[model samples]
Target: MLVRLAVIAAALLASTGTAFAADAKRLGRYGEWESLTYTEGNAKVCYIATTAAKVTGGEKGKNSTFLIVTHRPGSKSNDEVSINATYTFKKDSSVELQVGALKHSLFTKGERAWAADPKTDKAIIATLQRGKEAILHASPAKGSDVAATFPLSGFSDALASADKACNIKR
Candidate 1:
């Protein structure tokens, strides 16, 4: 009986360790991500969070959207989400962003370019960053840079704000 109990304890410990390792790997690769869509003048800017799954593109290696996992601080429930923002690099090295059904192009050479939702005509600008994680910031763009640098913390806030402003429940 003693030997059997010891074996069972070892098995349990191994399983627990595996579970923790899996969780850590997931968090490290993809921090929580959110999607947002906002407008500037007549252009609409869409923001999406990139995920490990999409980034890796499976074993076949296909281009895919980013993925986000969200959990409230005190809530027991968690959610997995994704964002769709089409990007096109311009001849001038600027980028165009299309979120959901809205579209906007940006030029960061001079000051900042104005974007607006075609439907609402609300003006906004987006800042895109790519490093360990990809981040896009959507704001009024009036006094903001079309392409600005931001830290990881700022990226999280900008993502959340885009979700709120774009009326994206997911």
Candidate 2:
């Protein structure tokens, strides 16, 4: 299931222009996370991602859900956080990520959610780095709210692989 999700996510990011990569190469898999890199025009794109460890929701079409952090050194974008909920989000609704006491709200569009700004993205990444797990609470367009827990094991190594691959400085 995870392998399928990783493939789907890579394809989706490429097609949606979020990853900005025409072809992605797998760097390695660390625990539940995978690091990938690709070239987009002249820039290099790198990201680490993981699928949900546990998904508890009544929402249908809850497949291929995952969380990602991308780095685009050419664009000076780093630690850009995004989530694929696998279901169209409720219009104008927000998704909340909880790691310990840290909580962040991400703006939703279609099946994806992203931090409103780079600062928020940084904070969320920091929280993920320090927490053992992250729980995402989201509202679907056609069903009850859904909550997914993503484990943070090996997240640091995965992010490091992406950072090195993209030449992103800490």
Candidate 3:
């Protein structure tokens, strides 16, 4: 009876471990990122630091555009993140990112995309919701890739800045 009990306990531990691993994976998907803030003309801008990746097949990759908006007094500026590279997502779940002289394939799971950069030795990924927000997941892009994630708040700040600069009251 003791042997049988031990077996059951071991199985339970294994299952629990798998569950924990899955949950940990989600944690890497979305979060906050530290980026540079600058002023362009009358607009306050923010751009996340990034590197260029590669793309192929004459397909143009997607560029990182402003993603969020917040309008309040005193805080009036546009924020944007540098995509580093451009990527194109096909209907077949294949994605590609192009940066400088390099191009690489992107891995997509559901609404998320990931890629590893050989040059920078970091993993570059993004989680995007249609018509909602895009969070860039940047890592070392090389050996021991550690993701430095960035959330959507920066994008929203940029939008607010633009709106205020343009005097669009709504």
Candidate 4:
């Protein structure tokens, strides 16, 4: 099941016509975090994925909820965060990521939310590096709002694994 889900997640990030293998290499596992690496054409793709530890106030969808921090060296996209709400988000609404004393916003699209730009990505990654936990809040289009919490115990290690997998520094 994880293999299948990894393929789907990779496909979601692939450019048009790009192909990804169904199985992704397990770079390492750190508590709730899992570092995975795969290939899309000639580019190396790496990401850390984790299931939400808690979810509140929304009906569930068929797909499981997850959070990912991806690195795509070919596109210079590193430490890019994306969350799957598992439910549609209200139009024009945003998801909030609270990490330690910092609160960052992610723009929504369908059931997925992402950092607005490279600056926001960098900031969020920086916070995740030192924060103990992160909470993702989502407002569904037609249902109740949901808040999902992710532990950060192994985030730094997972992130380092991703960087190594993608041959990225810092």
Task: Go through the candidates in order and give each one's C-alpha lDDT.
Answer: 0.30, 0.83, 0.29, 0.78
- What's the lDDT of the predicted structure labeled candidate 4? 0.78
| Per-residue C-alpha lDDT of model 4 across residues 1-170, encoded as one tens digit per residue | 46545644554444223344354778888867888888877778898877777777777552345778889999888888988655678899998999977999999978788999988999998998888889988888876778888888888898888888799997
lDDT (10s digit) by residue, model 3, range 105-140: 545432234343332223221222111323333222
Between prediction 3 and prediction 4, which has the larger lDDT? 4
In model 1, the runs with Cα more than 4 Å from the true position are 1-47, 51-57, 63-65, 68-80, 83-155, 167-170
- Using lDDT, give the best candidate's number: 2
TM-score against native, each model: 0.21, 0.89, 0.23, 0.85
Comparing 2 and 3 by lDDT, which wins? 2
Best by TM-score: 2
Candidate 1: 10-residue stretch with minimal lDDT: 21-30
* lDDT tens digits, residue span 13-42, model 2: 643756543367888888888888878778
| Pairwise TM-score winner, candidates 3 and 4 | 4
- Residue 137 in candidate 1 has what lDDT? 34
Residue 57 alpha-carbon offset, candidate 3, angstroms: 30
How big is the positional error of residue 47 in model 1, measured in Å on the Cα after superposition?
4.6
